[model samples]
Target: MDNLVIAATERSPAVDFDFAAGVLSLKGESYPEDASTVFGPIFAALEGFLGVAECRALRFDFELIYFNSSSAKALMNMFQLMDKAAARGVTIEVNWFFAREDETMKEFGEDFSEDLEHVTFNLATTQN
Candidate 1:
């Protein structure tokens, strides 16, 4: 399948999901006018890809500078999907990257990974 790429906008993040390579990354800020409208298709695409990915090294990178409450919910859902895929034998790695000075973002990342057991979750900080 073709890779899914969504360019970043002032109120949304960029999404780069490479199904064949098993690398899915979301970067930049995220506070879209409608969270579900922005993330629903992404969720669907990820679900479809993970369903047939088999045993593979899947990496999901979330490098968000800022996000709203609704976006937080969407992020949680994405993490849950990754966790489920990992539970089904996919070697999943999730890297949550926040600004070095953003303690709230770091805490958010921690909260999101709290229930993840099957997937390896890493809290990372971007360099100055």
Candidate 2:
């Protein structure tokens, strides 16, 4: 299947989901007025991909400088989807990248990974 890519806008992030490569990434800021509008397609595509990806290493990178509460919710949903896939025997690795100076985002990444037991999760700070 073809990959999913969305350019970054003032209010949203850039999404790069390469299903064939098993590497997916989200970058930039996300505070879209309607979070669902931005994540709905992502959720669908990921769900479809997860259904067929078996025993494969899938790395998901989150490199967001900032995001709103709604975006946070969307992020959590993405994590849940990943966790489910991991539980189903998929090798899912998640790397959360936040600005070095942003303590809040760093903490958010930690808090978000607390519930994911089946996936390998890492948090790293990116130099601004």
Candidate 3:
């Protein structure tokens, strides 16, 4: 599957979805005017990648500096999809990175990590 690589902008984050390398990364701030429009293609690409992939290990990295409530909902959906994929026997690892001073982002990661059973959630604090 072709990878999805979108440069970060003021209203959106950078998305680097690599199927061959088994690494998916979403980084930067996200507060788009239309959350569904911004995330629809991303979720579509992720679903397509998972459908044809035989890779046993999937690694996802999320490094969001800021996001609105709508984007948060979209992120939850993304995690849910990954959780389902993991439950289907795919080995998944999710690394959630937040700024050292961002307690809200850390809490968000913790909340998402709760329902995940088959995936390993790693919370990391970064300077940037």
Candidate 4:
């Protein structure tokens, strides 16, 4: 599958999902006016990547300065999809990055970890 790489903007985060390397990364703020428009293609690409290979290891790194409720919902959906992939015996690892003082993001990571059985979720704090 082709890599999904999108530059970051003021209202949207950067998306660097490499299907070949099995590494997915999202960074920056995500409060776009149309959350669906920003995330729909990403979800589609992820589904396509996972559909082809069932045993590949997937590593996801998410670092968001700010995200609206709609974007949060989209992220939850992505986590669910990853969880399903993990259930199929795909090794998955999710690294959630947040500012050192941002407790909300840490809690958000914890909440998403509930649905994942084989996926290893790590909450990391950055100095930014």
**Model 1 C-alpha lDDT per residue in residues 1-128, reported as the tens digit of each score:** 77899999999889999988889999988888899999998888988888888788999999998999999998888888888889989999999998899998999989988989899999998995
Q: Model 3: clashing residue pairs?
A: none
CA displacement after TM-score superposition, residue 10 of candidate 1 (Å): 0.6
Tens digits of per-residue lDDT, candidate 2, 12-123, equal 9999999999999999999999999999998888888998998988999999988999999988998898899999999999999988889999999999999898999999
**Which scores higher on lDDT, 1 or 4?**
1
List, residue by residue over 8-118, the lDDT tens digit for candidate 3.
999899999988899999999999999998999999998887776654789999999999999999988888888888888788999999989889999999999997887
In candidate 2, position 67 carries an lDDT of 94
lDDT tens readout by residue for model 4, 18-114: 8888999999999999999999998899888877768889899999888989999999889888888888988889999999989888888888888
Question: What's each prediction's clash count?
Answer: 0, 0, 0, 0
lDDT score at residue 118, model 4, on the 0-100 scale? 72
Candidate 4: list runs displaced more than 4 Å.
none
In angstroms, give how far residue 17 of model 1 lies from its true place.
Answer: 0.8
lDDT, candidate 3, at 52: 65
Give candidate 3 regions above 4 Å deviation: none
**C-alpha TM-score for every candidate:** 0.96, 0.97, 0.95, 0.95
The candidate scoring highest on lDDT is 2
lDDT of each: 0.90, 0.92, 0.91, 0.89
In candidate 2, stretches whose alpha carbon ends up further than 4 angstroms from where it belongs are none
